[model samples]
Target: MTISRRSLIAVAAAGSGLLALPLVARADGTLDEVKKRGTLRVGVTQAPPWYSKDPKTGQWSSGLGVFMGKAMAQSLGVKFEPVEVSWGNAIAALQGNKIDLMFVLDATAERKQAVDFPATALLWYSLAVLARDDLPVKTWEDLNKPGVRLSCAQATTVDSFLTKHTPKADIQRFPGNVEAIAAFQSGRVDAVGMFHPPLLAARQKLGKGKLVVPTPAESVPSSVAARKGDTAFVAWIDKAVGEYYRSGQTQKWYEQSLADFGLDPKTVPPIIKEMIT
Candidate 1:
């Protein structure tokens, strides 16, 4: 489908007619309410590459989610309103009518019970490691040694993954991604393992280490979240997300976000699963 700038602007112009209507009066669907309210409230948090808040300005800055959110809102002829929310409360935000949508949330079975997700994925992110230049890691097994040291966030999927697959390696646990990466920066650990997006920025900032998605890469598809039973909203999001991927806009936004984060896109692993090599 061709999405032209003129078409998007036309849609936005049409939304002005419904701007004065009360949100409660729109019972047709979430889309109707959004048009009436003239804003698309998207849940966001301080997650780099996906969503990040500027400390000095207290504004939603460059990230894949921010770009996509703006594009989605524009297509709907509404303003983009970012509602700050953490991973734990993202679903609750939707349930409480606090936010209309959220991006990059994993569609786990447990979460499915509480919220709806698009049939299409926003992107894929894989478990990757930022290891010392000298470490010879071609696969997960290469790191499963008694001498190798790894650091990851405590009680996270990364921690569990290392414990199961690289049991012999000395895995250090930290409070979060920042602390875990810091351990590697301090030379206390030979590698730090986490999702590749955040590691992209870390590698650029530190100017050392090799970011590798070891052979037989383990990855997960992440999707958009909406309030449960909002079939109309979920269907629209699915179509929009699918179009973004097929047209390569998803990758473009991701690469743009990397550049905005001061990282070279060529040096980082692609977030789209199929693009990884």
Candidate 2:
């Protein structure tokens, strides 16, 4: 079904959790509590295209996952409250039982120890590179040489990606994207590795960097996360996510989010083109 902007808002607003009922969990865990409490607590982060906040007002708005979370809650007849979490804390927040759902998570083996994923990927993302246009790096091989400086967020997928793929590069590690971007800006590093959409935002901020979806165009599946061990709750979420894909809501909102963020539709990472399948 085609979704209008008005319908998107009304649905998201309906589950904004402004009037949360008292949480009452059934023996089934979060699924029952979500339905009973009338609020689906969704963990969000400042990751662009997934979640973001206005710099001036600090008011949060749509990221693809935010819209998807709203739809998932709507399907369950519950509202979803966006709970902010840091990238470093995403796993801990879920493991500690701080949030009922993680709207965007990759099903890595280490993470699967703590959380369960749906049978299908909610989205796919390519590890992207943002670099000075004039850098000698024109291919993945160029960046895989000694003294070719690269920046990555410590403990993030990009860090491991670069470590594995560009081992000879002098990889500088920082606590998060802010520091990684700063490192790139100050000439401490020649390039930065992360996902594409956020790299697009970084390109705009830096004003002259080139966006590169490294050759071979690799991408990974990204999924939603729920605490492990509760097969019933996990199965319910799996079915809900599967239905979300079937309804065509995913593509509609994904395009809208890209437009809202001003990313060039032509340059969207290949994984985006592969999402609906």
Candidate 3:
């Protein structure tokens, strides 16, 4: 997908305190190159509080990833530049050297094959269910039945979760979360699957419906990812994230983001307690 000049400018502007990150080639001397170019390139997507664009304001909010990326850029004494990447290509963009860092990533074992996960996780997410009030989606088993209809964004963890756990259910897939939510809102599907926070954001826009936990919310670690061999940059990321986690700075940004995105603080999953503390 073409990165619109408008999008680039918005990202560049959003990160006022951030060091300039450009979407060009990854230089060999990680620190030296960034200092010389005066920018630190990071990847982003329109994935709500993580990274999102305001339709009304036409502005970009760093959310969590960009918030953290900005700090990293500051440490490097450069500006943060965000590169447009889809959920499907975020990993590839990092591993292929198209982007220096992917600030938001799920640390699945399979993904660990291509990227290195730092010991310090940036945050955790809970997979939650959003179903029609009338639908009886009390558990994963209930959604697993052959006739029950479920919708999840394509190429997402939610999609893989439903496919792997509820193979018998009728699953309708959409290109993105917006389309999937539209299907659910229109009563064409039973439930919309996503992380709890994004679902909270959806509820703000689509009224709070029957949002339920299908099972015990599984805490998934979300981290910054880098190519397997970029040992120096990866180590720096680990140090940076560890410091943020230790100083309670990450939690601070998270709570502020909750307010910024209109997500109710109480609705944040208990899994965060395990990760944050």
Candidate 4:
């Protein structure tokens, strides 16, 4: 995953000139407002193996969001400023100009109608029903049966996926992943609906085996999003992401980061790499 010197220079050139474009306006109608202010505010959650804090330094680490923010800032020649937010607060943070970009966001049709998604298919995240090995739930279809409680984050893509495909299942909403996992551990829920990486980490930490099943087909891609109408910013971001993908830097980051979290990079489907390439 090496970037050629020529491509690196081209990316740097693009970043330096992105601000000169009149169309690269902020969500509030100002050009490169984030850069003009000298900081790129990024939205992220505190979910482990996805987004989390370094207890010793009080700095952020360990998530795709962190890497995405770092890469975005480097490509755009801006300072990276992370805003730790809950799932509930993420969208408002973007709309209120508290954050310039939301990473690890699900690009649903409903959300796309509001936010500008510059990087689509950044990661092919799977929705899974994580359950203790003792549970009978082994697949997406099994989770749809009656008397099974499925816990998920509120207003998340998992919720929407469940609503659309497993409408009959009893769905429970938690404020965040911690509560959802807590409920599952307490036997209050039959299974927790979550993304793949976090579920794998949780199982490792608990020293228990958890079963994970992919969501039914028709799930959306996860993406990086900006406020609606920020076409210039979106275009600039699109170019940066394309360059990163082509350079193979993204694959390198994935391999290293996933290994750090005790997850297997081989779990990423080959088709996802093809799509990004």
Candidate 5:
């Protein structure tokens, strides 16, 4: 799976036809193909409580993302292979055939063009503004005020959304969420726009930070992604996700993962059980 520049350009030109090629096969069955091959390679970020490495065990253990991946692997009878990827590289890694799936990604219309999303909506996330408590910022509208600096991850859906919705705000790009948060904490940026949980977790750790008064103006559904033409695998994922949601394990995983991260389980939205089932 060595994707060269020329090959990428060629694939881009062919587009749908290129995507239809079978990338991997299941061994014992359509599912075990991944297991017999050794691991279900997953693309994830270093965001703690979402997808990060564990210091004590020298293994990866994060939030619902890893939990979902493990569940999928187990249901499919495969081994889990968590690949640590930067926010910027995650999508590219998927496109370049470096990994089998991405556990977390906003299912924006634009992204749907490149990847296939399973029927289940993994989570719903709100874009939040995090700023110093002393700042005059109070709402999403305040973020549009003159001279306000905001930071978001490069090439992320959030960046695109902010650019379209809040064109007045100066947007800075960070390689990943951690650096963006670091910049905001150091006062290098006036505000940081990111998903609710991690930002809320940061606020709790810092004590006395002002989360913009009003909630996110827009909410986006997130989902697991596989290569565009992996129909059988994608169908299996849809069925597995459906069964997981139906069995109530999905909600349980969410509650336990949030609790493990010291986040309030109440903050998690009700699982959209209907979509998966």
Candidate 6:
């Protein structure tokens, strides 16, 4: 199933919450605070290919977010400091000033109530599945049969999506991506479900599987999160991230992260929508 540029762009345009907006110049004080503090605190968690902590060094070593955060900090002439925060608490961290910003957070309507997100999208990730090579799937409906088994992290967006769309399938919910992917690797499930970026690494590591974004493709643009009402900071982040996307730097960073994870970039799906085919 090859993705045409027109189709991918249409899928991307289906969502409005995280897409870039008109850059209104504002002087929100968060930028000044970060400058005064001499460090830009970025919220991070152990989500590979996006955010990860090195076991040996106990540092936020490599990932797309790490690269972007460091670049943003450097551009501001400050240090990049990664503060530990779970996806659940990232909003709280921004609200309470525990961190100055968080990268790669989706700008959902629910999340918009708590924190301000930049108008510019940090990157795009789509709901995709890594299915056994034998299972021919062209769409989500193709996997909605009673005998098919799909695995995903419990209580995640992926699980929720699978549950809603493929209710007849044997949807096995595991504790996390590792367990979900393990189920597929062990031949207990026909496929492992997650956003495309994480599944890319899994596919490379497993050395087999077909990665496909089902028809009626669902894609979301993720963005940087700042404190609510921090218009200036958000605008600044928006401009910087927009530049990254426009100049193709975001793809470079993502490719580097995949390489760092020991995956060949050619074997994985790209984060950029236009590069999907």
Candidate whose lDDT is highest? 1
- The predicted structure with the larger lDDT, 1 or 5, is 1
Question: Sorted on lDDT, highest at the top, how do the candidates line up?
Answer: 1, 6, 2, 3, 5, 4
Lowest lDDT sum, 10 consecutive residues, model 1, at: 16-25
Q: Write model 4 residue lDDT over 1-277, tens digit each, in one string.
A: 3546764443334322221111223345423676677777888777655576778899887666788678778665778889877765565566556778777676666555445787535656556667767777544677677787888888987888887767888899999988888888788887888766567667657655464554343333567777767788887777776676667766566666666667666643211435321
Candidate 6 lDDT for residue 265: 76
TM-score of each: 0.79, 0.67, 0.64, 0.61, 0.62, 0.74
Higher-scoring candidate on TM-score, 2 or 4: 2
lDDT of 4 at 153: 88
Q: In model 4, state the lDDT of residue 29.
A: 44
Q: List the residue pairs that clash in candidate 2.
A: 15-79
* Structure candidate 5, residue pairs in collision: 26-33, 27-32, 27-33
Q: Which stretches of candidate 6 lie over 4 Å from their true place?
A: 1-28, 134-183, 197-208, 214-216
**Deviation in Å, model 3, residue 218 alpha carbon:** 2.2
Per-model CA lDDT versus the true structure: 0.84, 0.73, 0.73, 0.66, 0.68, 0.83
Model 1 TM-score on a 0 to 1 scale: 0.79
Candidate 6 shows a clash count of 1
Model 5 C-alpha lDDT per residue in residues 1-277, reported as the tens digit of each score? 5546764554455433334222333234434457667778888776655675677997777666788888777766678888877765555566656778887676656556667889876665666767877677645666776688888888887788778766898888899888888788888888787766568677667654566523334555678887766788888877877777678777787777667766666643344434221
Residue-wise lDDT of candidate 3 within 89-207, one digit each (tens)? 77666655677788767776656655677777877777877888778866788888877888889998888888988899899999998898888888888888887766767777887
Which residues of candidate 4, in runs, are more than 4 Å off?
Answer: 1-31, 127-198, 210-219, 246-248, 262-277
Q: Which of candidates 5 and 6 is the stronger one according to lDDT?
A: 6
Q: Number of clashing residue pairs in every model? A: 0, 1, 12, 1, 3, 1
Count of clashing pairs, candidate 4: 1
**lDDT tens digits, residue span 1-277, model 2:** 3546763443334222212122222366777778888988889888767786678787667777788788888888998788888765666566556788787677876566556787877767777788877886556788999878999899988888788889988999999998998998898888988977567778766776777777766687788887756777788888877766667666667766766677764545544435412
Q: Can you tell me which runs of candidate 3 are displaced by over 4 Å? A: 1-27, 54-59, 131-194, 210-216, 275-277
